[model samples]
Target: MEEEKRRLIMYEKLMAEIDLGIHAIDDSGKTVIYNQKISDIENMNPQEVLHKPVREVFKFNEGQGSTLHRAMTEGYDFRDEKQTYFNNKGVEITTVNNTFPVMHHGEVIGALEVTKDITRLKRLVQENMNNGTRRYRFQDIIGRSEPLEEVIEHAKRATRTNSSVLIVGETGTGKELFAQSIHNESSRSAGPFVSQNCAALPESLIEGILFGTAKGAFTGAENRPGLFEQAEGGTLLLDEMNSLSPDLQSKLLRVIQEKTVRRVGDTKERKIDIRLLATMNEDPVDAITNGRLRKDLYYRLSVVSLFVPPLRERMEDLAPLSEYFISKYNDLFQLEVEGISTEVRKLLASYHWPGNIRELEHVIEGAMNLITEEKYIEFTHLPLQFKRKRPRPPEHNEIFHEEESTPLLKDYLFQQEKTFMQRVLKEHNYRVQETAAAIGISRQSLQYRMKKLGIQKIRE
Candidate 1:
């Protein structure tokens, strides 16, 4: 008898320490056990709820009552049901509950309920939905290269209809730019435009955030509209769509097919009138082959696909892009910078920009910050990361000269020209225009000669 009493005490201690809210009642609907978690969730003291009838301690909405009461009296089990009720103090509480009937020899003895509080999560989702806005449009995209223009044309076509779009590009290739441009150009321009990075949140939370939550979808889930509902009558850009789990990808495919969404843990489905745009940083074929993406979902989202070309593929746009960034910073920094020097342009063109336009913009921005009274961005102004990748110019002592045999006239002339240009540039403190004036040649002529002779200003 003492052992049984000890075991009962141990059980009570474990119940109190459990993370979930636990509430149990007798067949008569009177509370027999009320744990601390439930007390916290309901904002009620255990003393206030213990031994009290559930109907008297809490008030449910019309047509809804206690899940524990129904489970005990009706001998039924309720799984993942959302319940909202007011405590005796009139504070409203929302919970996701799993209520089960406790049976003794096939007869209902009582009921047990396990619950999770999600009131805060619900409030946050509502606040986020109310605050989001779209800022990018087609004109905001900068490049004029054929590869960029071709994709823009396709994106424009995407705006004419409500077809799902899959935008494929490398990181920093501006996939979201096209997605926003499509929305702003389309008939849904007046409505909300929402974007969610699939990789931004964990799988468990993302499901509820994307599809919305029904008051009791899961622990901490509140009845709130997801990204789909928030972007109603407009566009929803799912950036890095391939990052989504396969199960979610399947659900997304279903939503695309049916044009409807069912909130997490809710039985009813609501029709959504929103355009879907998804982006992938990697090739969809590779993503599918590696099992990171679903083939069916890929097919669904690719109805009007676009590939934003990397910066390396469109070298012609470099000059214009650089000029644009220069002008942008000139206004922003309140400076009078003219343009990039020829050598700086050469260095910018030679390196392969792995981060694409974004990297180029950062390089320009970094250079802009270092500018004081300089008229143009020079080779010295470029970032060290860029300089490290390119071959460093040979130092004066490192320049090789023929010693064993007489050199060819072309080779000897090349050496002489390189040596002369290096000396003149050093004298002018590596100023291109000043060096050109000292040599009695046009600035463009001196620049061309320097390029041919492999002459570059060495950093001091």
Candidate 2:
């Protein structure tokens, strides 16, 4: 009897800890087990739902009812069926449920359900549908480098025709910016422009999102137009297209070829008149070799391919990009920050930007936030993480005297302390109180150190 009790406790603990929601009910529709996850998803307490009928605890619109109840009564099983219903508190909840009938002695006794909450995703999709404004233009692209200009010229030409364009570049290389520019410059500029990241959602959900679902298609699917249909007259930019599964790549290829999309679980094909743009973060050849992208789809989409060069490949644009970002943040933060210092510029140019322009923008933004009553962004203003990227100088023990070739430990320590104090003082904008607190020293001690070290705020 003690062993049986321990096993039941273990089962209850497992159910409570699992990420997915778990709920079960008896044949008479009385709630038997309701885990914490399900309670959280439904926004109801276990005390309110336990030993109560599902119909009494939750409200479902006519023709759309509980999957658990259906599984118990009809002996039916549902897989990846989306259900939207109101809980006892009158809060609407959306979930993807897999329900199965529980059987004992050849008779259905209850039903069990596992659910995944997708309420946030549903709201995001709705927001994307409502907000279809095209904000980026060709002029918005910042670089004037040869490689960037060449790509811009090609993108400008792509806008003349409705050919599908494939953009290839590393991550953070502004592939979406180019895609948006092309769409805004295209003939369909007046129409709705929608962009979706193919990797943002799972295959099951993405398939339905990309291709509209018909009513009666799944458990709770409504008659809704997909992104292709929503972007009827404009361009649809699918970011990270290479992340899509091979099966989806095939379906996309068919749509590109026929200019029509068949809704999921629906036979009727609807024609679409819109330009398609896709961006891949990796090389297309690599993606195709790895079987993540379909060869046929690549050919169809690459009718007009534009390769945006990474920031490392176009170093000439660094100065202009940096200045532009400074001006942008100047207006944004309402500051008169004139420009970056020469030392900071050298550091910016020396680092190979693995994250490309986005990283540079963020670095500048961060440095600007630390500035107050300073005209130029200095080396000290850079974030600590970026500062760590600077090349390490010789260690104190490694520094040798010219005559003895022995370590100058005393001189090295004095220089290091002076540099550290100066940097900390500058970081706090020459505020003695803040600098003292930052360095964990009393105000008098910090003042004496500054006097001994000859560290004073110097304006450029």
Candidate 3:
């Protein structure tokens, strides 16, 4: 009886403070005591809450004493981070609650229930999860070329590790896309996948944006969370890591090494638990030599490095992707576009695509906009530069085989420019300017090639 009096005194004292919706109910289901927060959440006064049956508020039995029914029946604590509740007005809200039975001399006497309104919190979390661009798994990466396959294989391998990743590729090569796929496939998929382009922001604002400042720490008056803190237990992709200035690079290195960060102008050190994945277009070696990127940060980031081959190098993936893009744009533009013809295929195959797959996609869509077709994409629909030809007839053996041929960079395209130039001058009766223009070179450059190739023009 003395212990019961002590419990009542403690509950009364707790009622004066402790606000996150706390309530106590006797085994008879009477609201023995409750805090103001509960009444506030229910929009009722404390005087209005006393002596009420908890069943009238909860609309269901809480279980034996404070114990969860599932726990008593299943031999473990029954827990759910999400549970929906509805009010009398048919207004629905989410809640997370924890309950335990009060034991008095081995007999269940009462229950304590702690609940929080999570309806708004759940909405924010769901919004973050449904950010579908990153939600795409490996199966979503649309490519089948050997080079593309290699990248996908590497990305899959990368998903299993927490090590930092450095994806090197030219701009628009889907480096960030690969990073997102990796994060989605990893164990951290349940957590936030935050991404920011380091190159896109200037050095002055980059630090503040990355490591948030406290209230009154800067021009902003509100306390804001940085990407690192927000990405706790998740992945942080620093797109274009190579562009970070040396000072910022040092700060980034410390975060990776120690897993900590200090908010701007705040002496307190906040620890961050984040997985790091970054992309860079510039060569690491060149960046190091030129002092644009720090070598230490590069070493830290490249715990695993992946290269996305240029599009010209992966042309084997061209035809199918081209056809796919044509169809895609046709649907997007509401055009009745058809597939590429044999002649158009020849143009796409022979040209050196410096821009890669992204460039090819743009080229296809651009062509689709101008043409009206149903059966074939004519050669005239291609980019203008692709139409220009070498003056000499067939400098290359020209593989015009069926689409089943192996996709790989051809060796003949690596032939000496001078030899090709000589063949062009000899065939064109040494009209240097016309020959130079036809083969995509200047006359002076052609003359230099003639001197180098020992080709004498038939001077009139």
Question: TM-score winner among the candidates?
Answer: 2
**Can you write out model 1's per-residue Cα lDDT over 259-358, one digit (the tens) per residue?**
9999999999999999999999985655877999987888788887787877766777888888899999999999999999987876677655778888
True-structure RMSD, every candidate = 16.1, 16.5, 18.8
Off by over 4 Å in 3: 1-133, 383-460
Q: Point out the higher-scoring one by TM-score: 1 or 3.
A: 1
- For model 1, how many clashes? 0
Deviation from native of the Cα of residue 37 in model 2, angstroms: 3.9
Question: Over the stretch 1-460, how does candidate 2's per-residue lDDT look in tens digits?
Answer: 6999999999989988998899999989989999999988988999999999999999998998889999988898998888889987788899989999999998999999999887865875786686566589989998788778988999999999999999988788899889888988888989888889888878778888888889778756768788899899998989999999888888998898899999988999999999999999876765776898887898899888887887866878989899999999999999999998988877777666768899899999999999999999999999898997532123422222233333245445657889899888888888888888887866755764564455654532
Single out the weakest 10-residue window by summed lDDT for candidate 2.
392-401
Residue 374, candidate 1: how far off, in angstroms?
1.9
Q: Can you write out model 3's per-residue Cα lDDT over 1-460, one digit (the tens) per residue?
A: 6999999888778776775777666666677767877666655566655676654554332432223333333334344333555444445555566666667787766666676654543444344344434576777666688768877898899899899998888777778778888989999988888887777666755676678667656432236566788788988888888888888899989888999988777778898888999988866665777998887898898888787766655666777778778889888988877688887777777755656677678778777766864556777776665466321123432654334333333334334555676677778777988898888866755664454333567751
Quote model 1's TM-score: 0.59
Q: What is the TM-score of each candidate against the true structure?
A: 0.59, 0.70, 0.56
The predicted structure with the larger TM-score, 1 or 2, is 2
Q: 346 in model 2: Cα distance from truth in Å?
A: 0.4
